[model samples]
Target: MLQSSVTPHPERDRLMTRTRRIASRLRDLRSAAGTLPDAVVLLDHSQHVRWFNHAAEELLGLKRPRDRGRLMSDLLRHTELAPWWIDGAREPLNDVTAPGHPNRHVTATLLPFGSRQRLLLARDTSHLTRLEQIRRDFVANVSHELRTPLTVIHGYLELLDPEDVPELAPVLDEMRAQSKRMGQIVEDLLTLSRLETQDHVADEHVQMVPLLASLRKEAEALSQGRHTVTLDVVAPIDLLGSPKDLHSAFSNLVSNAVRYTPTGGRIAIRWAPSESDGATFSVQDSGFGIPAAHIARLTERFYRVSSSRSRDSGGTGLGLSIVKHVLNLHQARLAIESEPGKGSTFACVFGPDRLLRGTQAAEAAAAGVPY
Candidate 1:
């Protein structure tokens, strides 16, 4: 064997020092993240557990080395979680009981990270869930309690003849209108409470043609020859869901279009196939358009773009909230598009699974119009 003497490169020492500094900083970051209260778990592309924090062990019963590299579904053992974790469902699962700890509830959220990696975060939500339950119970009870008195008051007012007291006729009319508005608010609250209890809609096919016709009539009646309300149902296909729920949602949108639009504005209701191969029912109005800031919170109960305008228009403010719940039950979503001072469009997008196309729809597809 021949031996050769070689000198070390000048940059070798500098390179080693830089590499050590980077590694030290990474270790410090990892340690800091491990101490967070929320349980954090990192999964590889195959959904095998890659790394987890101390909080994960305490909250999820995951043990180092034993649970490492195990599939999340195998460790969590929740039937519904796999779809949510793999299919990219945006909503977080709430009140998920931890393994061997029924009392400890958590809300879990999954986010896709670098490449195909996933980050699973879970936070204890037992206290928040309890608070939500209490709020729901209180709202349900109060709404139910107010219904009887409101009905009685409305009935008594109806019995009193306006012609009998001509001098007080205007006062009686105003009172009657205000009472009806209050009754509507209470009824809407009850509807929201009922919807909250349901996970999904019953599988009953709803006729779309008749529903659209009825809604158009309602919009015209509410408009009273003010706005020009038009219905352009490109695909008149039946939907597999509760007719009552769909009607309420559709009617609320029509009514809102009429209520918000100016006297000479145009309101167009359209039902057409979306570019994504789904069906969309949209209500577009050339009204005093909503501000961008208010669009996000439109579905919140009693939320209004302008409180004064909402009150003046006799809006219960629960209309959009009810629409949201109805769409959720039907496995649909409400998309709002608006531009201030121009117009607004509220579209309910339903997955293709909910559509039931008939021969007429095929003809409509060929002809490119539905009468």
Candidate 2:
């Protein structure tokens, strides 16, 4: 009697088949995730751990059911991680010590997915970090070693009397120029190395009025009546940074303008206010503008748009790299706008935290400063 109505319903059979297929796919996905080298953690909107793979257990020390509702920040308590997490994890946090294994280094990246859910991926970058450190140390040592020899060669070349060697005057001049350029390159490398090694810079009241004026003077001297160099101070605000370091960064921008600009070209240097009470120091030049493709790599060490042109302009190609390091220390950024045959503008954008407007603004307003 019970087997009298053993008929299969087509709709129910189809639904059962679809459900089995979905379950199989989910199991396969879990298997794939468990085998990944990167730690994969699923987080909710509150940044609480919802689920994780086997790699997460090994790398992030996350235990299933035990760390299920625990805060991600609590699991990974890093100073730099807090801000990055709070800021929506827009950028990756690199070379951070792994929470589970202190000796290991990891790069953490968080991406948002369905309905405020986030996927946290932490990859081991310990080897890459060590390689970068080794490269930096090698560069510093080589630059230091080359400095003395370069100085000696430059000194002897300076002492050479062109009048004493009438027949070899041109050769002597060329030798002296080459030596001087080499010395400059060594000095730039040393500066870049030093900047790279430092995590922070001394914060002091940087008088922008005087600093901008001085930079303008340096630019004019470099220009030597060749280019029309001008300084415009639209924002009468000082900065909170190491004066010497700031000067170096700003001077590099200005000098690069003079070097790249053709004779009779216009170069305008401006200190202007930006959004949120921030400031920007920009050097606009009517020179050979950089191509769009080469713009991104401009800050890389020894990166050049035109090697021969850079050499002819007496550039070491490390200037932008140095500027990048300096800006990173100051929590600033460099913005480049260029068009071939039109012009180029290099702007160092500083945040509001680096601006010292309290005293400087009062003084400028009281004195009715006209820049």
Candidate 3:
């Protein structure tokens, strides 16, 4: 060969230095992984274990040589975890307990990286879960204890005669109203507790016409000639759900519309099929609408957009939360649309899976027919 290597490349030294720095950084990262608190695992697109940190070995019970290249499902065998792992869930799984460590609760999250690699992180949530359980228990116990006493007070207040005590008539009337409001709140709390504790609802074909008629009557009574209430039934499809739960959800929305809308305001209740073959029962109102800020927390228990206004309107403030729970049991959702001064529309949109098409009489006789 000819003598062509007389001069070295000018950038050869700089390239070598950069490569050495990169290698050093990678080594440092590997060392840091050994001391992390949360379990960390790296997986390929096929869900095969690429590597795991020291915390993973301790928390997840994953061993280096034995678990490497194995499928993640092969190690964690919880039935509830199978769906999230296989479906490549975008949302993080909360309150998930690994099969081996049933008592140790962990929240698992996945982060995608480097074109086919994924990083799985498991954070211990045992303490937080315990606190949540404590809160629920406290609320349930307090609500149950207050129910009998509240009923007694309400009954006694009802028995109080304004004629017998004419001097304190206005005060007694006010006391009765306040006691009645308290009773309503206590009842709603108990209902909420029962719903949270109960599992799935016993399904049946609920007659829509009768339910709607009942709701209309309630709205009229609540309105007391102050609001113009109208019912528009475009589709006569019965729902496959618990009649009691459905009635509660619908009536809550209707009564809220009646309560909030000003005198002579129009409240339209409509039932129709949605674009997705599902059905929608919506209560549109011309009322003092909700602010954008309050809309997000409208379904939260005891949350009031305007505290004074809600109290004046005799609202228990648990109506939307109850509606939310009922719709959740039926695999449906509430859609609330509003503007500050214009009006509000509360729509309970049921998925196609929950709707039963045909005559109400046929559906009721059939019990529950799939559409």
Question: Against the true structure, whose TM-score is highest?
Answer: 2
The positional error of residue 239 in candidate 3, measured at the CA in angstroms, is 1.9
lDDT tens digits, residue span 335-362, model 1: 9999988989999999988887887445
Question: Residues 1-371, candidate 3, lDDT per residue (tens digit)?
Answer: 68886787769978999999999999999889867888999999888999899878866778989999999987776545668877866899888775467787788889997878889898878899888778878888998898899889878988889999899999999988998888888888878887877768876778788888889999999888888889989977888888888898899999999889999999999999997999999999999999999999999998999999999999999999999999989989999999977899999999988877776548466654422
Model 3 segments more than 4 A misplaced: 1-13, 31-35, 54-63, 71-78, 86-88, 359-364, 367-371
The TM-score values for the models, in the order shown, are 0.85, 0.91, 0.87
**Which stretches in model 1 have alpha-carbon errors above 4 Å?**
1-31, 76-78, 89-105, 112-117, 162-167, 359-371
By TM-score, how accurate is candidate 3?
Answer: 0.87
* Backbone clashes under 3 angstroms, per model: 0, 0, 0
Clashing residue pairs, backbone N/CA/C < 3 A, model 1? none
- lDDT tens string, model 2, 142-186? 989999998898899889899998998999999998998888898
Q: After superposition, how far is residue 327 of candidate 1 from its true place, in Å?
A: 0.3
The most accurate candidate by lDDT is 2
lDDT comparing candidate 1 with the true structure:
0.87
Q: For model 3, where is the 10-residue window of minimal lDDT?
A: 362-371
